[model samples]
Target: MIMAYLEAKGAKNVRIVPLDADNEKLVKGDFPSLGKTVEVAIAAHGSSTGFKSLMNGKADIWASSRSVKEKEVLAAKGFSDLEDPESEHVLGIDGLAIVVNPRNNVTQLSKEQLGLIYSGQVSNWSELGGPDMTISLFARDENSGTWDSFKNMVLGKQFQLSGSAQRFESSENLVRNVLQNEGGIGFIGMAFVGKSKLLAISDGPAQAFKPSQLTVATEDYALSRRLFFYTHGQPSNEYVTEFMRFAQGINGQSIVRNEGFISQNVESMDASLADDMPADYVEMVKGAKRLSVNFRFQEGSAQLDNKALKDIQRLAFYMREQMPNSKLLLIGFGDKRKNEHRSKLLSKLRAMAVKRELSRLGIYPQKTTGYGDFNPVASFEGASKIKNRRVEVWLR
Candidate 1:
């Protein structure tokens, strides 16, 4: 969608050539801009295929719905660490929404329950407090990044998808299948939910949250994930570099929001203290409104990840233009720790890290606080623990 928008408005005398009649696989276009004609080709395959193409010198960028895997990084011969911030670019945010037929009474589920359903353990809707109908599973193909993310985030290593589950290459088709089947369940990108009913998902002890623009943007939703576009290190191609710059700018973010994904643009909304929240933490944010962006760090470190670094710049821009005089509060949370004091201190340090970054941009926050091991967004069992370590911004 971003590419199509750019081709229409940012370029002149555009020419499009489809490799196939459907134009679903390969496309080449000549976009005239800035006194030059830049030729660009896009191959719309599965995410794994994109990485394979990049490794084989067939593509300059790898568009993916999930993060690069360790094995893929090791396989790229000449590419710098694909996990590096320079190589990994977060395009936008998406939530993997569990959808079912609109007539289904089941409206919410725990992560564990979802795992069971997909693994074929809970094969009947009655098993989940729903109608007495046999459940049918629908899933993305093996090569799709959507499948990869769902496998890692929901299924995990303990369970594999049921052999009888139907696989789809298209999100729309999967949603359609679920819509037609009364007992069918499928996971899809939030944007593709269509007429299917969405289920609120809870992880660990956190409250259930449905995939929404705000929840996905804040990454509070259980299945929220980042969409990415990876380049070989810093992108040697001039056109690729220029396109990336445009995609990360304000106009590009607008296109992202318009296309039903959550853009990185900073926004604020009034929030009330929840009853389940800790009293002290609730008091801190009593009358404050929360921002759409959260500053999260790398695993086991205070260093901001690639997306958070970009968010700092976006937050700065937003503050200068919209809330120059607003008082900012930073609240940090951490995963469970054996030493309570150490956990609290570490959480505070994470907030301080964000403060320091914002300070460099001449945006000083008024207060920073830490709430260690309180209101975890995900379980502390595995890789999901990283989601618990984050700093949230609020306006007084």
Candidate 2:
């Protein structure tokens, strides 16, 4: 898309700049060229970092395998508050291809295995291999957004860097390294596959096949990601804006398809997909608070009523996600009117109702306790209110 557009306009000296932090830093001593209408340089940096390069005037344009970040947008808006910034565009769609060398006959790996490998657990080729060799893992530098997506989606969470691994400065280098190594696995922008053999993960959510143009378009690619180039807004430069239109328009999309990544156009997700998730991720519907519940039983009866049981069931579901790992305390509120012996038993039943209901729902509480007619939240002339006569979920 870039080459064709530059040629059509008769623009000269256009180069695809691989804008990166180091590359940006290199231009600190650059002196303005004597006379040149256009100059393009290629940098091998991630998308957000590329955006930074453009904003800081490190390059005429930057290429990336990711999209503008939320923070980058705020930064662009901030820069826009100052002077004019270059125009932005969405380059062709690109995804990170989770690849293993052709020598690797593992056939497929579940998301879990993929996570384990990258997290440095299953470190040997023999662990899931044909040869008794160490599994050579390659990864991109932290500066790359492609690296971020892989770490987030594949690793699930971050920890101290794995003690054994190889890091490359460029995505191009990472892809090449993976292709050249046996029993080695790594990720690179799908565009950089070249002659490397790609493997498929069967029954994957994205698809049940290998990484291919068909898989990407048909929604079978597991490692699909978006490619983006961000700018403050449309630039004041006619040349830059015109290039942006071509890059953001249909032409750029064609390049994206040729590059081997799936476009969000054929992408199956929403923008707010992350919002439906929790801050810690993993969709733990449980929340933390400090509310109390009271369960009261009849003077002589140790049986729980329908209302109490219903509330217990609710608390069970609400707490189910946290069960087995989280603890629950069941406190029974006893009625002020109680017989000496029955008082203990009545309060005990109320507590039992809650614990049993939770158990029935497969929500395990670590322990159950009974507090007979004790620790009343509210009392009218020492009388218990039915509203206070129930099991409550206490979130910690």
Q: Which candidate has the highest TM-score of all?
A: 1
User: CA lDDT of 96 in candidate 1?
Assistant: 96
lDDT tens digits by residue: candidate 1, 1-396: 434645745655555656663324333344443555555677766799899888888988899999999899888646678988889999899999999999999989999999999999999999889999999999999988899999999999888899989999889999999999999999999889899999999998888899988789989889999999998898888767877877777878878888889898889987555578877777778788899998998876789999999999999999999999898999999998999988889989999999999999999999998989887888888788899999989998
* lDDT, candidates in the order shown: 0.87, 0.53
> 316-371, model 2: which lDDT tens digit per residue?
54465343355565545454554635654655666677677668778766545444
Clashing pairs in 1: none
Q: How many steric clashes between backbone atoms does each model show? A: 0, 12
Q: Which parts of model 2 are misplaced by more than 4 Å?
A: 12-37, 59-62, 80-89, 129-131, 158-161, 202-207, 218-220, 256-396
Say what the RMSD of model 2 is.
Answer: 20.1
